[model samples]
Target: MRRTLDEFNDRRWIDKDGYQYVATRLGEAIASGIEDLIERVETERKLRSVWQWLPDAISAFPFETWSDLTITVAEPDAPYRPVGRFESLLRETTTVRFLRPEVALMDLCFDLLYQLIAEGVEMRLIDRPECHRYFLSTYPNRSSEMIRQDHFTILEHDNLPSYGTGLLDDCVTISCYERDSGTVHALIDTDAPAVREWAESLYETHRADARRVELQKSAESVPHD
Candidate 1:
């Protein structure tokens, strides 16, 4: 006896568990592909020079989560020209201008992570100092609304001093103070091989700068007595 179309489409075949099972299978396939892609990327070049790997390592998870991914690089040579009311703060504080580059990089990273999570991406790893020690609130309804209301702060930290709403995207904001001399040497996208090359270029540039700074400091520190 042949089964009817209704039987084929019955609850037995279309139950929640069945749907989960199919999703699980597809997720696994996607995860495997991502892993393979990462592996090939790592193998083709030296992984040590890739800065984006720091964030990518944290994002790699067992599930298929990420969709739209973007990597932004700050123009290192550009002078910090404060926008709007930020101009006053830039004039008042010495550290703020110096740290603008670092702040911009952190802001970009946080914004991307927040957007991904809002779109239903589960975070696996985030190396930012702020997110390292704590797990931010993940309540969808509250978090989603909060993100929509305050996404601008991520873009402009000069206006918003702190995340007042408990629903703030914690991935970008660091609770502890960082002492890296206020410079973002590089930004990377692990998914793209070209980004790795860019990271290498930055690494070289910074290495040269470090050597020059050390020599100058050494010269200045010589016993003047």
Candidate 2:
């Protein structure tokens, strides 16, 4: 059975021992995937392109819990387009390890990258009679006020979709952070063709942003001698 955030938190899911175990396993998986992508990029002599390395990086980690994983890269500063979708499968079962600084950093970077690419995605804590989990913003930011108004005015609501409903109605983004573990997974779902196209366009934008950052750094590094 799937565990809710409250149940997991009540059970001290983020305890040191549990956090360590999850982080270590997740880190190793991500590192391996990145390394493989790096090798392939080098062979193809496309080392300068981050997008070229993404596929291998994603393929490196097997997604066991998340049924769908989609990425969209947009223009620098623009919201991401839906790149593609993925289904995760776990290869093995193992015990937890301690969370090292490196592992934590890796997890943070992954989340940051996802947030940057997928702008306006909010994380909300949800509660149901049977389960609770952090639900990602499936709808655009504009709908937030309407949701808030509806929340206070209504006593009982039935139209809202549950987390991981696997429906294609609203574009959903699920950020998964293992309880009692350090692993973090972000899943995005959107059946909209326009959204997907936007995600792909974001890749070019990301490259541009990277170049701008480098330029700024170079400008700052110049000194009067």
Candidate 3:
């Protein structure tokens, strides 16, 4: 300890300010460092919860106790697209509020529709206008024709956020934007009451102003080419 102090002094690390720093609140500083270390360890453990390093991998609320849920994403794409396990969550769920930007029509048209419809679950799709012509050029077969407003509404994308949000009944999922790789979307799924309420409020507030989609009117009947 004496040698270490001598070395610190020699390196000018133990200056007058440094001495003051240790004298003033040395115990508190030590405690804070330990706390930070513990937090890092806990964070590392949570990150390893899932095989994939998603942003929202931890959930405070026990999944077994929750009922129906909701999900939201800042941009158009949903992280759930790559998550096949997400389908299991939808099986028993009745109503799901999918608040997001324009999604790939193929992703929602058949598989999602079939799962939700088969379960007789109410799946609300809230997004801006998706260019049907754009889908036609890249992908064939217009599956978006299957989206019926009878089950839900299509709200115009308004006040989009930078981060992704998901409200799963009691739990919530959040992710930050990664400009480098879209696949490496970080997730932070939690069941904190405050988070759930906040997410729900954001959805309800804009939902009032969202444009209600009339499926028949939104699309023009075109002969199969």
Best candidate per TM-score, number? 3
Candidate order (TM-score): 3, 1, 2
| lDDT tens readout by residue for model 2, 1-225 | 235544544554432364342324545565588887776555334213222223332334333211233432233444222111212210111111111112222222333323322443232211221111111122223223223431111111122222111222244332223235423222344344444344344333332332111122322333422
TM-score of each: 0.22, 0.18, 0.53
Give the TM-score comparing model 3 with the true structure, all chains together.
0.53
Give per-residue CA lDDT, model 1, range 1-225, as digits (tens): 125324533523322354342224545565588887886565434323333333443245222212222223233354232121122222232121111223333343444445544555422221232322111222333333423432211111222211111111211211212235443333322233333333334333433332111122322333332
Residue-level lDDT of model 3, residues 39-103, one tens digit each, is: 65665554443324332322443343122223322335655542333444445456667555233
- After superposing candidate 2, which stretches have Cα over 4 Å from the reference? 1-69, 72-148, 151-170, 181-184, 192-225
Better of 1 and 3 by lDDT: 3
Clashes of 1: 1
lDDT (CA) per prediction: 0.30, 0.29, 0.48
User: Model 1: runs farther than 4 Å from truth?
Assistant: 1-73, 76-104, 126-179, 189-225
Number of backbone collisions per candidate, in order? 1, 25, 7
Q: Which ten residues in a row have the lowest lDDT in candidate 1?
A: 162-171
Candidate 2: clashing residue pairs, number: 25
